[model samples]
Target chain A: MSVQDDLETVEWDVSEDAHITVDNEQCITCEDKPCLHLCPAECFDYQEDQEGGIYFAYEPCVECGACMVFCANDPDKGAVSWSKAEGGKGVEFDFG
Target chain B: MTDVAFDVVVVGAGRAGVAAAYKLADEGFEVALVERAKQPGMKNVTGGVLYGSILDDLVPEFPEEAPLERHVVEHNIKLLHGDAEVSIGYRDLELREEPNYTLILGKFDRWFVDRAVEKGVTFLSETTVQDVTQEESRAVVHTDRENGDIACDAVIGADGVNTTVGRKTGIQRTMRNEDMALSVKKVIDVGRKTIDQRFNLDSDEGAAYIYTGFPQGAATIGYFIYTFDEYISVGAVGGLETLRWLGDEGYGETGTPLYSLLEDFMELDNVRPYVQGDAVEEYQGILVPEHSYDTLPDRHDRRVALVGDAAGLVLNKGYTFRGLDYGIKSGLVAAEAVMECAEDGDWDAFGRRYDTSLEDSYVLQDMKQHRHLPKFLKNERMYDAYPGIATETLRRMYSAETDASGLTWRQAYRAFRRSDAGVLDLLKDGYRGLRSL
Candidate 1:
């Protein structure tokens, strides 16, 4: 099954506010763009038609914090800024 | 909506936070347990096993009262290569009552937090802690809600790997990529009868399987499968350092995200049957601290102490991972340290006592003993050359190529060296294995 299909099995309380935002312009300058690779939820994507070369949606975030850490350690500082979804407003695992 | 005051305010109501809050409340100290999730355990994930002996000291009627999934009676560690596998395992009936059990962290943490609430600890859910500021008279924990500032004598930081307390307090720097790993898991429902027949278990018995050598073995990614009554948790843990190093070849340039690695593992011929189920129950992931003992801070400042991942207490031994137990034990110790210093009316003694108590306890002692494991794990040969050596040697020894005679040990060793690794790689890894293990 696709990742989108896999994500459907878990529960999420989507928030109107984006808990994580990506500075796409900064991401283009990033040489490695590790978030495109490291995120377990595949929340970060590369989209050529976008203003910058990246696409990010916080809706499917499992709140693992990999993107935040990996991006912050990159040479370009970090294009991604992350915080937890307001309490009770993100992924909630029924069987973690 | 008024600002509340308590003797102790514990952050992140997972295993560590609840442990500290429960003990302090039992000791007659007013405690507040702040949680980020709507309920305890919703935001947490582990490899699905809890070493519960340490928990018995705090809750006497444990294994009986806990929300456990299964009693782990079998343990296996296997090395995988392509379609081949080599494993060693042990099963003991005595293990059914103590030491280890399979559980869902979401269910277990909620039950544990409920116990703390019953002990008179003020439980606050759906409240996010913004930051904390310390003043001369007391420590003030700031939260995101109206009048959410909590005044307290002390704070116990039990938040997970991405700790707000660690960063805001300046006690921990950003974790190095080498020191952390990304673990993604999926819980599958295949029914109790399927679990019994597939895993060869009785109604209450469970099995834990650990597999290494995947993603071509260069990345040191490990996979785990644990049997729950009617579900199984399957996942993979890949080191950040190696994943980044692999770069285009491993994570990004090659278009292989960490989650896809779990997919690849699940589809493997050897692993498919065990995990094939009616449906995927839940998908989850978390950042794990690995081989971090040396870099861990003192874990305390005057009235604020840290426990669990916030204190960098997780240990990733090559064959097994131990975090929940350490988190629980440290929470208990942090509570003891708080009570001791409070009785003496000396907050300055908090650090010394917390550190000394951990050193005297098994938590820190075990970490100190395996302090060099991170360095040992970095040797690429452990993931690549070693598994190849074992699988190739076995294949050569068992094949009946020649008419009658079987291959000798020396012949198999020669063929193995010819296929993948060399003498020097073997010697270096063998010696290092002896020293590290």
Candidate 2:
């Protein structure tokens, strides 16, 4: 099954304001976009439009904070900014 | 828009935060337990076996009353390379007499919080702690709500691996890629009778399986399956730094996708059968600390003390992964120190007492003893070479149709030598493994 199908089983109280924002300006200059590959919920993507942009959706984010350590923490590149959703807004693990 | 005050404020109502809140409230200190989730553990996930013995001090009747799934009496460790497998299985009735249980954290956390609330802890659900600062004589916790600053004598930051408290307080700076493991997990339901028949268990007995060396290109990634009554928890854990290194060396075409890895792990020849017909109940992901104990952040800053994953107290020793126990233990230790300060009216010494007392406790000692494990877990041979040696050696010895006739130890030795590693490499790894465990 696809990641979207798998994520469908999880319950989420998605916030209208995205908790994670990706700067495609930095993404256009970046060599390796680890966020696309590392996110467990598959919330990041490489948008291959004419500009070669980066796409991010916070609705399915598990709040694992991997982007904070891998992408955001890099001194040279600030492509990602991550934070937990507002209180009570985010995926709720029924069986965690 | 009214300001509130408490004797202590425990941030994040997971195991550590609740333990501290419960203890402080039991000791007649007004405590506030803040949780960002609608309920405690809603954001928590674990491929876990909660060792319940440590809870005796906090809740003596936990085993009988807590919302536990099953008492585990069996453990199976498997190393897989392709279709070949090398495994060790241990089952003991005496283990059931102890308090090892496989459980759902979402349910367990809510139950534990209720007990803490019974001890007079004010349960502040749906409230996120934005920042924490220590002023002259009080610690101020700023929340997302307007006029939500809560003044307390001390703040316990048990916010978890992606800790806002740790970052805002500046006690923990950057968590490197190498210092954490990202896990993608699923909970599958397969009925209690099926669990008993497939795992060879009684009504209350459960099994845990740890699988290593099979997700082809991902480094330091392991798979685990734990039984919880009618639900089975399956997941894959990989160190982010090692995974990046493998990607740099061109392991996969691109960086490893953790969700796909979990899917691949479930499809493995050895793993597929157990979960084949199960219905997916929930899918979750979490970041756990894989850093050495020495690399863990400072546990306290003035009146704020970090606990559990916020303090990086998790440990992975290849054979076992422990965080819940350490989280609870450290929370109790921090609360004890808080109680000591209450008696002496010297809250300024909270940090010193917590450090010294924890240094003297088994929690820090156990972590210090296994400090070498995180790096050892990143060793390449652990994923590629070692499982190959074991699988190849046993395969050669067990094939009766071959010329060697399945009855030769010498042939096993020959098979072992034909694999990637040398005897010297084995000895070095053996020594390192011994020291790490």
Candidate 3:
């Protein structure tokens, strides 16, 4: 099955509100946008129609903290800001 | 500082926090375990096993008390080169009963906290700690709730890898992609009967299979397949930097995304039958320490201590990954230090005692021994070149049946050894690996 097909069975408790924010300027500097490949949820993608050319959909986020650490801590990188959803309204692991 | 209401406060109600609370409560200390989740373990990503000998000291009758799924008796490490694989497995009947177990952390954490609560430990659920700072000799645990702030003589940061307490309190620095990993796991319901029959488990026994060699571009990636009572835990872990190298294009032409890797792994020829009819029950992801021994901060700092992921007590040697056992051990060590600090009324010495306590324990000692593992493992050759060479060598040796030309065993092995790195390079790598691991 495809990733989207497998995701149909996976459950997520999305915060509704995105707990992560990305800076347009910061994202453009790293055209690679490494977070797109590293994110397990595939919550990020390129949007040719958007202002920043990067689109982020947080609902599918598992709150893995990968994007946050990868972007925030890089010596020359600062594009993504991440924080846990309040009251733990994030991905609630059913088997995790 | 003198207004500390509780003797000690532990953050995150997962394995480390619960273990710390239980130990502190047994020492007659008023301990409060705070968690962001609705309940202990509810937010935890389940799967994986608790390895090493640390569990025995934490719980004497661990097998009976712990919420374990299966006792893993077989371990197989596979080097997947193309569609071929080379594996080494070991199984022992006696070791299958106790000490090591495959766990569903969501269930285990809850069971662990229940045990702690029964030991006079107070559990505060739905409380997310905003910051952890020191005030004189006390710790102020600020929460999101307006009036939910708490003060304790000592605080234990038992939160996971994305540790707010450790990072905010300056006990530890922010994690970098190089030192972290994005690990994804999926729980597949394959039926207990099918699992038993396919894995050849003699009731309650399980297997742990770790694989590498994901194309040449994504060679640094590793995948794991573990057996549970009625489920199979399949997952993949890649170094953040290495994973980033794949970009969105995915490990070459395959265009594999992070989640798709699990699906691909489950569909492998060798794995297809075991999970043929099974369904994906759960899929989750989390950030993990990438085995840099420095991932762990100083055991304690004045009125505060760090344990588990917050403390970064992880020993991931790639082949034999670990966190659970080390998490429990760190909690026990931190708890012992807290008990001593309360007994002596000297919080400053808490840090020293904690370091000393862990220094002698297997957690720190084992970590120290393998301190060079990360550097050694980061070699790109390990991912692509080695797996290819190993698999080819085995293929050549095993092809003696089809060879009428009469190729010697030594010639067969030598044929593939030259395929990748030469003898000198292999010798250097072998020496480095031996010393590091």
Candidate 4:
């Protein structure tokens, strides 16, 4: 098959389980959400909670460990923790 | 029916296969080189850098006739975080001379294949080897698109990472997904003047850059800007597992998400200028075999021998991107082993000789030496903490404020500490990085 045809016919699937997590209760009123800036996939979404606190969405995480590595020393608030989702349960790429 | 046979049959017409055929033919062995592609390079993929030293050994004065893009004059390594970037790089004029390192080879596979053909090696294109018809002594090859079988004394499987010959011969059972790297690249057309001025290069020099840090995740992303006459070959490579992980998290996996990531990077007020207005002429993706030394299959089995990615010889460390050279070198070594076996009239000892020679050569030594690099690169901190901390540190160092007293370097250290990476962790990472080299 032609390269273009082969690429068009390929399919991609994503898993439902989230690999990145954030503890909402411990967060402080930090002005900048560092996780948002460091994420390679830009997976995190920062929004105001009902109590005027920052809420995060951890979907679309590439699991490159940027958040956890950068947030390890935060004394006031725990930013993020990362782990492998599950074996044989993540993304599948036909082109790659 | 006519009976046609050779002393050696080299499959796949790629860098490895062509090199093997050329070397064997040069040593007075009748060689038949088979290729499945419409042309030698039509189905081939490469990063387009022909590490000059490797080619010079194979064919002297190669730079004179080789389709080289430009001699690399600059090398840039960047740690990127959000809109901030921390870069350390070098430029050298020594690489621009006669034995220059050129960013070339859009059609390198074909070029090598032609050289092999010129050296009395038979070229059979548009033909695929379906299977090997083995006898007690010799083997005959069956082609899918050809009418007759071609028998040979030995067969070399240089068919790349997904080698059917290697699979059929049971030399390699399968290649694991983690053992591969997924890369997306594009040949971009920007005016020569634009490329030279933007990258701080003259018309004859090329530049390559690698970025590791948050923007690339724990996964390493390398961008190369090889100067062609009026275009630049730019791209990124990351672990296949990392790409899949991102895809599983609901980001599209067919390169659109990665393209979006690149867009986000370029949109950053700092990075937008370098790639602005460059038209992407071609976009392609390839799988780089990144299996550790433990994953490498046996070099030989009876009449069959594996070379190149089929043998799992790809090195992705920081110093070099070296699969093609490995392919060429291994191909030559395999041919030499076969020549020795031919001289001895001992077909059974061919496999052992090939393996021992490979172990003795730099091909195996390099892989064995850097076997830990893949795991080290896979460390999350390499992608996560370092980029952000470095970029933030650069920002603090570079920014100018008019009214207030400047913050002390101690404050800068505090900012780095505030980023959550400690001195001990940095030292550990440094040791691991050093060990990888």
Candidate 5:
């Protein structure tokens, strides 16, 4: 493998269930959403879906739990659940 | 079993293992160093600050050949409260001269391993040590994914924080939840010009910043910015217990996860400007043992010895982030003990000597000295009240208000005492700080 290719495969085996999931219904319509503002991986996204409701995706999540800690509304209580992804899955950084 | 014994066998060719192998080989001892990774540093992760004193000790004139990033010239501490920030910092040209602290170590493990190989230490890469078969006189290290068992008089386990050798030999217990700090880091590819300008550093000079207080809260959160050749490494670390505490308390509004906290920290108006044109090249998360004096495990068994993170020797004070240095130093000490035992022909005496050396060394002393500091940092007021007070006080002092308000510095201080802390609480905290330090 090329040096770059070899570097690309230095994957960390994250659990399959290791990710942060958010319940859109529980999102409070606040002027400033701290979760959207604070995530290091830019995992949280806000957009108008086809039906006009705000759509959110956390595909790039690193599972650091900053949103759950800073969430003004209680997300961990009911709105969001954070858990380790299935073993050998999640974002793998080659250069880190 | 065929007789293929070496004077010493060091497992896991990370910083600690490499250092020990180098020292022993240089001292004319037959050493066999084994690594499970494809290369020396393939499985290693470091915050990437090569502290000057340790490097100077290992190789007195190291700068000429070391893969150094930049000589650090500035150090900053930021206390964040909501949207406001209180910063205390120092910049000196002296730190950029000879014996200067350098932001290096991307290829440090490989370089160190090469040095050991040069000194006649056999480098065995892509070899995994399955278990140690202990006999009365010597230990035979069994290997899978490799050919045969290699016997050695003594073994040194430097296999980072999540050590398999330490666990298999029962030299130390598995790390508890509170004893480990989960850290995530990223290398953002901001060009050299952008990095120099954004961090206010000159050519070949770098800056480092540490943050505490709001956003990070009572948790031990530290963000470091180190200059690479063409990128900047930004990273944060927090205790797992504190992370669990925050999760239970229900904090984020939009359901921010712990790993994403770094993004939030970087996106802050205060931090965003530095990386305006940068692109993230990598992101990684690793566990760091907090090196609490209480959590230190006994160093030796009948034939095995634990060194580096296996013995729980990571030090993370607010001002200094040192792990590689401790790892190297402990490995050197362990090697010396093993060498002493080889001379005396007493394995039991060797094990005792290793433990005694650790207790007498500066590594153990430093950990014991700062034993109480970690608990003091866990205090919520230090993150919440102190940062809020300091920031508000600075704001009032610097405010360009035309209105002639009769607020003296003392009165301004009292107004900023809007924190939940009272005089007695402050006094008790003061005492704790003094005692801990």
Candidate 6:
């Protein structure tokens, strides 16, 4: 099964508001978008339609902070801004 | 900074944050704990094993009401190449008690935070710390909520692997992908009876198994399986570069995405049977501070000290996992340092004692001992070639059928090396592994 399929197996409490945002322009310049490659959540996807840009979402995020941590280290500063969603929001683990 | 301040403010109510808050409060220092999650442990996850004698110091006895899953008495490490595998394990009754627990963070941290709460620690849950600024006499913590800013004599940034509080204190700079290991874990519901029979454990006894070199596995990735109460936690993690390699390799060896590698590992003959009808309980991913110890974030900086993943204290001792132990231990150490500064009434050099105290503890020493391990692990041959060498050689040696006049152990060993690795490379790895591990 795909990661999405496995993710479907686990319960999720999706937050309407997002705590993370990406600067797509900066991402276009990023030689290798680590978030698209490494984020287990698959929150960021490469959308060639936007001139080889990225399609970003935070609802599926496991809130592990990998995406933010990776993006922050990029020389293209401020490409990704991350924070924990407001209290009682974001992905909550049942058996974390 | 507002006048609404305490003696100490511990950021993030994780293992380290709670530990520091508990110790500080018991010492009669007014402590404030702010957690981004609605409650403690809600935002936390770990391929967690609480080994070593650290938690005993925090909670004399983890209350029976505590959600401690199991006591891991068996240490199993294996090398998997396809369905066939080789593992060497040790199970001891003496090591089954306190501190050696299989913890589910969502439960354990709640129980632990309560212990701190009883000591008069004021907890601010569902509060996000916006920024932390260190001043001459105290550190000011600004929160997203109104009147949430707190001024404290000291700040303990146990906020976890993604460090803002740490960077604010200048204790940690920008963290690179090379400095972390990324993982996605699933808690599968294999019945208690199935777990017991499959893992060969008595009731409440758990086994942690680490496997390397599965069919699609590389030198950088490791698959971990742990029997957790009614759920079996199975997962994988590797260095950032290695994961990048997996990403670079389109379709990988499994001819699918990276997650497919995990499903593939699970579907193998040896793995598939154990969890055939098991349900998937939970799935999540985390970025852990398993970077080489040399890249460890500064332990403390002036009035602001770091602990847990924020401090980059997790040690990836090859297959063995140890993070929460250091996270909790350093909380106690951070508490001691914070108290010393509070007594002296000096916030500038407040946590100066943390460096020396950690040096005196086994935490720093353990990281120091295995400082070279990260580089050793990067040597792809160890994971790529070694597991195959070990399993195949053992397979040929153990087979009772007379195959080519039944080679001796020494001859079989040479033959295994002949296939994948040469003698020189194997010797080099052994020498490096010895010095590093």
TM-scores of all predicted structures: 0.95, 0.96, 0.93, 0.76, 0.80, 0.93
Model 5 Cα lDDT, one tens digit per residue, B235-336: 777775455445332233323244556667778898778655435566655667875687676667767777887777888777667677788788989888
Let me know the DockQ for model 3: 0.57
The Cα error of candidate 6 at residue B109, in Å, is: 0.7
Chain B alone, candidate 5, TM-score of 0.92
- State chain A's TM-score for model 4: 0.61
Q: Please tell me which model should have the higher lDDT, number 5 or number 6.
A: 6
For candidate 1, what is the DockQ-based docking class?
medium
Worst 10 residues of 5 chain A by lDDT: A1-10
User: Candidate 1: misplaced stretches above 4 Å?
Assistant: B247-255, B402-408
lDDT of 4 by residue, B172-232 (tens): 7544446666555556678899888988887878877666663546565555445566776
User: Residue-wise lDDT of candidate 2 within B384-421, one digit each (tens)?
Assistant: 78778766666666666556554456766676688777
DockQ, candidate 5, comes to 0.08
- What ranges in model 2 sit over 4 Å off? A50-52, B216-218, B245-252, B405-409
From the highest DockQ down, the ranking of the candidates is 1, 2, 3, 6, 5, 4
User: What TM-score does candidate 3 get on C-alpha atoms?
Assistant: 0.93
**Per-residue C-alpha lDDT of model 3 across residues B1-437, encoded as one tens digit per residue:** 22336788888887878888998898888988888887666678633578736656656776887778888888888777777877888888877555688888878888888888989998888777888878776778887765777888888888888888888888777678777877887788988988999889966898888877664536457888889889888888877877666644742222346666667777788667755764788778887777566555555677777888777777668677878878888889989888787777998777668878888988878888898888877777787777777666566667665443445566556654666667787888899899888
Candidate 5 chain B — worst ten consecutive residues by lDDT sum?
B247-256
Which 10-residue window of candidate 3 chain B scores lowest in summed lDDT?
B247-256
Ranking by TM-score: 2, 1, 6, 3, 5, 4
- Give the whole-model CA lDDT for all candidates, comma-separated: 0.81, 0.83, 0.76, 0.65, 0.67, 0.77
DockQ each: 0.65, 0.64, 0.57, 0.03, 0.08, 0.53
The best-first sequence of candidates by lDDT reads: 2, 1, 6, 3, 5, 4
Better of 1 and 6 by TM-score: 1
Q: How would the docking of model 6 be graded? A: medium
Off by over 4 Å in 5: A1-96, B1-3, B97-104, B247-256, B401-409
lDDT of 3 at B77: 86
Superposed Cα deviation of residue B133, candidate 6 (Å): 0.6
lDDT of 3 at B373: 83
